[model samples]
Target: MDWQAHARTLAAQIVRPESRWFEPLATTPRHTLVPRWWDSVDGQWALQDGARDPGRWLDVVYSDRTLVTRVGPVHADAAAPGTVVDGLPTSSSTLPGLVVQMFQHAVIDDDTSQVLVTTGSGYGTALACQRLGEQRVTSIDIDPNLVATARERMNLLRLRPDMKVCDVTGKLPGAYDRIVSTVSVRPVPASWLALLRPGGRLFTTIAGTGLIVTADKTEDGGAVGRVTPDPAGFMRTRQADDYDNPTREVWEKAQHADGDSVSVSRYPLLYVPDSWAVMSMLALDVPGIDHRVHEDGDQRTVWMLHPDGSWARATSGGFLEGPTVHQGGPRRLWDALERIRNRLNREGQLPVYGARVTIAPDGETTLSRGGWTVTL
Candidate 1:
């Protein structure tokens, strides 16, 4: 397979003809960065080796989709074939289109601007290098192994950028004209504001939701901006070996408990993650609801679990029918979801998108729109 040709074709499909990113996307060898990755199969993460299946590898690599390179602490390169690990994706090469879109959001127009971006597969870093010279680009990741491997892969392509292993939430390596994070965070890190030059811009999504915030540094050690109309979701930044796994006891209970309250849902069963606006609002309001869905023939079960011992389970016979909900613990998880859905139905759109975003020096974030305000 002609991987270069395929990449060019993908670039044409994803980027506009007049975009500066067109050439970068067309030339970058994504296959080299993700020669081995994890693919979900039968509810298990199976290792996919590119060298073993060149055709399948070329197709996935050139396509505009995310490839999981690490699950928990297990890098796909070290996993044996037929190996299956059931865990969350810890690292990945983000979709090419999204990466380009984020770069566009960062407004990297000047060749002199020093840009700092999160390094996952190093694919985005490579693109940045192609657009703005390698001297002006710096990529950082929390995992040392990922940073080293990314540097090695970029070296193979003869595209070198400063790659460092450091927690992005902490002090940055250097001052930059722009900081674009593909990873999400709860509160906007104060270090980011400190590292930015006076007019420096930052782009990132809120953790666990599809809220993309584009802000510029202020003189008062704060930043002010509005959420983008387009939605984006990224994995949360982690300083440890891996993210904390949800408690097994809570999941087991939520799976088979009658709960403290039971009633028929007024609205049909809905998955929060399916709708960008709805999910963003819920994440801002409730903060940390873990969502799961199980389907058996015509029966569907949806669950929302919070770390605070709150869980809600909704079950329905068919797609159009309302679900019978069971809730337990302190917060009524299902009711909260329903209220958001009700607002969506009445207002025709959630007020989250394009809302005013303000981040104080102390890391307090407030989103205000139409008299509704949420502080994070």
Candidate 2:
């Protein structure tokens, strides 16, 4: 099937030599983990079950991209061949490149520091098992079926990493020298700190935003690290079957609701996902600013909202000039976005990745820079 050739090409394009994950990216057999996967078609994500067409399956399996394994709560394997699941992606094995990037920051060593990684499609677990012996690794996922499938796949490769179905946002299972999460978290869980031995390290992505934090546990029961230069996004941990579906409601409110909530914007059309520095600043200053983007034939819309009754809607009409922005509520959404842009423009700075993180003994994380502090 020329699987090695396909993997080699995809790896070359995504994995850099400077990355610590070069070996895993080059050696792990990604084609085996995702033989068939769903593809986006006509604005909906569809699936091609592995047992179907070997040719089409191999191409998808080796491609350096994400594949949706579950829609809502239904696993792709349970669906018929060529079936389309028009629901939000509830589970996925992240692309090999991004997985490697997360692992690159993990900084696994030859020492016998037990490693813990979140299991989704089991691909990341396989890579960890490959780097450190399977015995030294433990991988967990909230979905029982996913953990079961991942365990089977690891066994297929004759590896034996401990597998469990557990929510990483809550209490972790055991003590570890290193903890790395593929799933994102809103706040660095205090349970995670308790799970780490003194001097242990953690590499993880922030939930609801594109930020990666790598911190080391201190003797005083706290941690500290700076944001990474790269932008990485992962599925936020879900306590329920599905997220509350707030986007539609928010959009409808914006279209219908009106009030005399005057506000002066802080910033411009700063696409949070595109700009790491601004994204970091927003996340640091105002934690939990949810963003979503939808694109049509010629129009693109980016919506920004916060739990604090703040909302901003920006739309690009037909690929023309500046976007039309409508912002309302107690806090001016556009103003905040513009404020961030202005700070970057005037002071030639944005405090995000470079901002210092201080995890207090009480589990409060505060980002501070230039006499400004944001409690997260």
Candidate 3:
């Protein structure tokens, strides 16, 4: 089976009918960029030896699922064929569908345009280079090894983009007509606005949420746009491991909460990933909302928690009993959710994708919709 054929099919699945990325996605050789990857199995990430499974490799490689190409600081190139390291997925060539959607948002012009995209496994960089020539693209990544490997991969295809080992969270390499980030960001880095020329567009995913923002650079050093209705999960920009091993006390409480303080809930089950509007609204309003989804046998569980000491759990249980909720911090978790829901009830809809963003030069962000404004 030709991996190129598979890549074409994968691209079709991701590119929208009205998107211009279709032609590029269909022609680019994505498998060459992601020669080997790590796959999740048994709740653990294991190395998937592409060379060993050459026959089945293309199937996994082109699938919409994320393939981890680096662990912690270790690139998959250094590891042996069967080596498996479990730290955290540090880098990857994001799923094809997501890449296409992001590019679609970018709205790249075919008339002598330059775009800056974060170089991960170089798959996205390859796509951009394929769409817009190598000279028209500048790809940067924080990890030097990733840049080096990506350069090699691009060289193999004879498609050389300006691959640089620079941190996108800081200064960008050069001015660009469009900037698209695969990595999620807590705040739209001021450097992005500085890099973009006037009338330029910046497309990126909001860190810690599934919100996709497409903003245009304004003359006053700010950008604004309505959130994309499509939901996505980008690896959060990390200085290091972005997780903490739960303390014994916290673990115990999560496993066994006190009664009355946490009563069983009665709410319809909703996956945050599947609810772009509600999730985006919550992200803007609540700010720091962490979520975890657990699946046991036939049951699915979702836990939503905010930094302000509010938590909600919606199990597979019926809505009559409500959700197992706990709130004691400054901001009430369930109350906040209920408030958003009540607004939706009264207004007949929630403003999430429609939320307007005003990114200031000082890096302050304000999200407003229907007269309600949240600043972060």
> Highest lDDT among the candidates is held by which one?
1
User: TM-score: which is higher, 2 or 3?
Assistant: 2
Q: Write the per-residue lDDT of candidate 2 for residues 133-198, one digit (tens) a residue.
A: 888999998888888877777777787899988888887788998998987886788998888888
Model 2 weakest 10-residue run by lDDT: 259-268
TM per candidate comes to: 0.98, 0.87, 0.86
Local accuracy of candidate 1 as per-residue lDDT tens digits, 1-376: 5789989999999988788889999989999889999999978899999999999999999998999989988999888887889888999999999999998888887554799999999999999999998989999999988899999999999988888989999987799989999999999898898888887889999998899998888888888999999998999988787889664557889998998999998788898899899889889888888999999999999899998889999999987888999999899988898899889899898899989999887767888898989999
lDDT of each: 0.90, 0.75, 0.74
**RMSD after Cα superposition, model 1:** 1.1
For the record, the alpha-carbon RMSD of candidate 2 to the native fold, in angstroms, is 3.1
What ranking of all candidate models by TM-score puts the best one first?
Answer: 1, 2, 3
Question: Which is better, 1 or 3, measured by TM-score?
Answer: 1
Task: Score candidate 2 by TM-score against the native.
Answer: 0.87
Query: Model 3: per-residue lDDT, tens digit, 1-376?
Result: 4767787787678766455677777777777888888777766667777778787887888788778888776677777766667666779888877776687788876774889999999988888888788899999888777899889978998998888887778877789889999898878898898888898999888876777888888889888776776678787676543334333233344443542355453345666656766776777677666666787765666766655455555566443445555544355555666676677778887776667878887667777778777776
What is the C-alpha local distance difference test score of candidate 2?
0.75
Q: What's the CA RMSD of model 3 in angstroms?
A: 3.1
